[model samples]
Target chain A: MLNISNIVLEIFNILMKRIVLMGVIILMVVATVYLWLSNSGFSEGEGPYLGIIALILVFAVFLLIRRIKSWKVGEPQEDELSKKVMVRTAALSYYVSLYLWVFLLYMQDRVTFDKDRLIGIGILGMAIIFALSWVFHHFRGVPND
Target chain B: MTNRIKEFRVKLGLTQEELAKKVNVRRETIVFLEKNKYNPSLRLAFDLAQILNVSVEDLFSFEDEK
Candidate 1:
């Protein structure tokens, strides 16, 4: 006979998976729309709609992520392996973002474009590095420290 | 760190979920421990050893394989 605890655990796992998937889908959609808006806004001259779209998207994505993260907070503390992964990934993300900022600045000497756009790209690159590192560590084995 | 978690678990006739409960960890953690894919903390090792009716040294080993 199945125990009540077993049934509850099963339900919990299914709910967790669904919630995680929903978070992933939200991240993907936010990333796509953010990229598209950035590309089109700069290419076609800035306007009120572009500013409004960017602001709304940023706020919505920020709120959604915060909600999802808060939902995940608390519970079993991190394992030794998980702690190592987080520290390593965060350090890696920092270094990669630093180099990306330098690279973008270096490119500005050869090409003519909006310094504003370059600044935005630099900031976006850092966020991408952090997100990618988190995703990588989630799916991959421990990073080489 | 290779371990005899699966062997001991089988001997006790406990499912992964059941063992996880006794040890207070997720079932995936137990699965990984059994497969030698992840190392357990000292506390977890002790908990598993006790639940499986063995010593920590007997549960896992660091010596070279034969």
Candidate 2:
């Protein structure tokens, strides 16, 4: 019962899925590198790693912007439930980040905080948000049976 | 909330996908709404009413007994 158009659609869907997965992998690798660079001590004239990390962060931001810009919003687009789930997931992630930041502040004895650590936490928060949103979107209405 | 979306959609000879397109939502959203498993936002409800040519009250209902 598979028509040519159906086959093509399926292939496109698979390709899109693969691209998303790859994007996630790249993001994770960049995040790991960033964390490692931030935590490890560096010698004089060895600041290029930070520059490389900044470039990777910029690339990640660009990809996210591109994805959002290409997202369709109007008629024949994703339905109300999907939109609701998306909004809810984002809100949840924001609250989670807020609570975690508060906890970190409470645990620290010093009034001042490390800028690099703060930035690292921010990146991790965003990663968690995206991962959770994607998971919720994928599994929202599926039956357990 | 309960609705007669499926009946209206059928009467108008519109498929779920067609209605979703008209309402500016995803097809699965239409499915969920029809099944009464999901509630929509006020804006979305208004949009759906406009597309269905019905009032929000006509499209949706609230029951205290439920």
Listed per model, the TM-scores of chain A against the true chain A are 0.48, 0.41
User: Which regions of candidate 2 deviate over 4 angstroms?
Assistant: A1-86, A105-118, A133-145, B41-56
List clash counts for every candidate, in order: 0, 3
In model 1, state the lDDT of residue A60. 46
Q: Per-residue alpha-carbon lDDT of model 1 for B1-66, expressed as tens digits?
A: 678999989998999878876776656567667766677878888989999999999998886556
Q: Lowest summed-lDDT stretch of 10 residues in model 2 chain B?
A: B20-29
Report lDDT (Cα) of residue A99, candidate 2. 77
**Per-residue C-alpha lDDT of model 2 across residues B46-65, encoded as one tens digit per residue:** 88888888899999988765
Residues A1-145 of candidate 2: C-alpha lDDT, one tens digit per residue? 5698899898567546644765787779887776766787565544654564555566556655544433433342244566566677677777777777777667555656577765665666556556556566545652211
| Candidate 2 lDDT for residue A56 | 54
List, residue by residue over A1-145, the lDDT tens digit for candidate 1.
Answer: 5698899889678646645765676678678767876776555454543554455446446645644553354223344555665787799999898899888888999888588878766765666677678667645644222
User: What DockQ does each listed candidate score?
Assistant: 0.19, 0.24
Worst-scoring 10-residue span by lDDT in model 1 chain A: A70-79
